[model samples]
Target: MADSAPDRYVLLLVPSAIRCQCRCVVSHRAGRTDSRLAARCAAVASVGAAVIHFAMSPTHWNDWMPSGVFFAAIAAFQLVWGLLAWWRANGLLLVAGVAANVGSAALWVMSRTVGAPFGPHAGEPEAVEAAGISVLLLQCYVVMGAGWALYRRCRAEEVSAIGRSLVLLGATSIMAVAVTVGLASGLQGHHHGVEAEAGHGPTTDEHLGDHHDEEPTAPGEGAGAQTFDHHSESSVVPGIVVVQPPAAPAAPPAPDDGGHQHDHHD
Candidate 1:
């Protein structure tokens, strides 16, 4: 009878043991999932950081370039997007991230065309070459891909409301960039005009003074006559010898009378 009682006791504990095992398995799986999500978020943030750095490459992380402002704008979006992605602000992150990618692509295209994109007088090969076409295109894919992935997995409540509100910021930034280019071009023109005037002032005066000094000598014909003599002098002499014309034939007797008189005397 004691053996039977022990069997009953084990039977009573079996359910609890099974439940504990199930709970442990569930917890372990949950932990793994959380880790994966965290890792993905970190990766997303890292990509955002890369985008920010690449955008600033033209300006060398400074403001020397006109495109630096556009890059600054992109970096700002990247910062916000990274934070949102980390916090699982899926909606706002998606909204902002896609826009950022579009804007960045546009910026690259602008760089290839004119200095107007970077700033006034920035010119080609300098600002455009700041980031290679392949590298920038790759970045565009990364941003868009990450943003899309986050949006797909993110729940409705994951992103803050602010993200949704600021989604259009990307569009607004482009217009602001255009305005900046115009203003910078104008300023550059004004500055160049001032510099040109300053630079020419002294040079023009010096040139005028030099002309006045040479005025009296300008009409001299000696230079022209000498140039003509030099060209024809070579044709007259192969070496240094000057050829003389043969002596003219002796002149005929001037008068026959004088000749006859000389003959009679002989």
Candidate 2:
């Protein structure tokens, strides 16, 4: 029997902060001071990660980023943030979350407007959809939305922070739907523009340039003259080929006399 290779194990060292957070982010994975709030935070943050995962793909790497790399970053950030939120809202994490969301939203708008840094992603629908979601969650829901809710929760007892979270979710959902419609409309407009450009471009009316043109009917020309007009046509090429019939072979030259010709006697 052949000898089997020994098994080997490899371990990768992760940062303390990330290690701590990872344990916290999983639902019911660890003991938290407030389990209810932790679960809710984890759910939202995990959903953000899932949304980004749906938007991005590993295979989407190209000269132009397939919008996947950007979303991957967001997913990573959300996971970390969710873990932190489970334990408590550390001011640093809150600030980082807000910054990440705002920066991403700005970058998304820039990409759509002028495609800075990475140029553009071949007008991909998936890319556009990803950008729209980023706007909905990070920009609209997290930064603009959750911040205010958290503040209100601190200020008053009448409104529950849960209500704010629900409102934020609703807003994000509405934004997603609206953006989807807008994206469809914009794509349709662009397609029509492309069709118009194709229909009327300088290349569309093109004709083969190499030609032989005959002169207009001459004053004395008859219908038969027109029949022979082909021979007189003006050609782009000055040279013309002429074909002639092969000549009949001449009778073999009168056999050469053998030097003496007999005179005929009368």
Candidate 3:
């Protein structure tokens, strides 16, 4: 009876132990899957940001060489990093990804708000454009995904309210469109506003042409010429005036002229 009782107890504990082990295994697999998904999300976002940077690099090159080179370097780094992350994610890669994206995003915000600290266009606040905003959004997703992958506790909630991959695809499309528009518009800093200002203020040659198209107030009037109109007998032109003498007071008006016709012939 004692042996049977001990046997029964051992059997009961064995099943319980098996169930616990199964649960642990399932939990671990679930965590691994979630991390993989997070890594994929980060990779997609990073690549999207890289595309935007690549698209903008040429335009920035036109504005400033250093800026263009910086953008190109960033794009290349992000592209390689994203590819690596997608293949296999580790703690170091996740941390580096987060740091790079955050720093870039912060720089963008600073340039937009307080203006760039150094450059030919220094001290000039860059206007917020669709492309810039799109990049910011992508970087935000990259940071979130990287953070989630780095910490398992974040897997408690869905990384995205919608499907993560779907959301990333949509965001990537939006960024592509924004970058196209930004390139078409020629960015915001020296392209839009400065060009518009130049357009509004015509050149000296244009001013001369405009003046030529209009009729002048008087003859010999080119610029800075002022003329006054006087009686029909005399003319006042710009810097010169002409006046007719009184004709010796009209010969005293011919002494009332009614007595007789006194004519003077000359």
RMSD of 1: 17.3
Winner by TM-score between candidate 3 and candidate 1 = 3
lDDT tens digits by residue: candidate 2, 209-243: 22334557656544544322354555433343322
Instruction: List the candidate numbers ranked by TM-score, top first.
Output: 3, 2, 1
- Residue-level lDDT tens digits of model 3 in 1-266: 77899899999999999988866764555424566677777788788778888888988888899999999998998888899988877789989999999999999888877778899878677877777877788788889888987786334333443465575576567556655664554454434221234345778999777544543465444465433432333544556533223355345535564687655522
lDDT of each: 0.46, 0.47, 0.72
Model 2 root mean square deviation, Cα atoms: 21.4
Better of 1 and 3 by lDDT: 3
Please give the range of 10 consecutive residues that has the lowest summed lDDT in model 2: 187-196
Colliding pairs, model 3: none
Please list the residue runs of candidate 3 whose C-alpha ends up more than 4 Å from where it truly belongs after superposition.
1-32, 153-198, 201-266
TM-score computed on alpha carbons, candidate 2: 0.40
Question: Can you give the TM-score per candidate against the true fold?
Answer: 0.35, 0.40, 0.57
User: What is the per-residue lDDT of model 1 for residues 42-141, given as tens digits with 9 covering 90 to 100?
Assistant: 3354344445444444544344554455556555666666555555544445556666667666655665565333344455423333233433544454
Best-to-worst ranking by lDDT: 3, 2, 1
List all candidate RMSDs to the true structure.
17.3, 21.4, 8.8
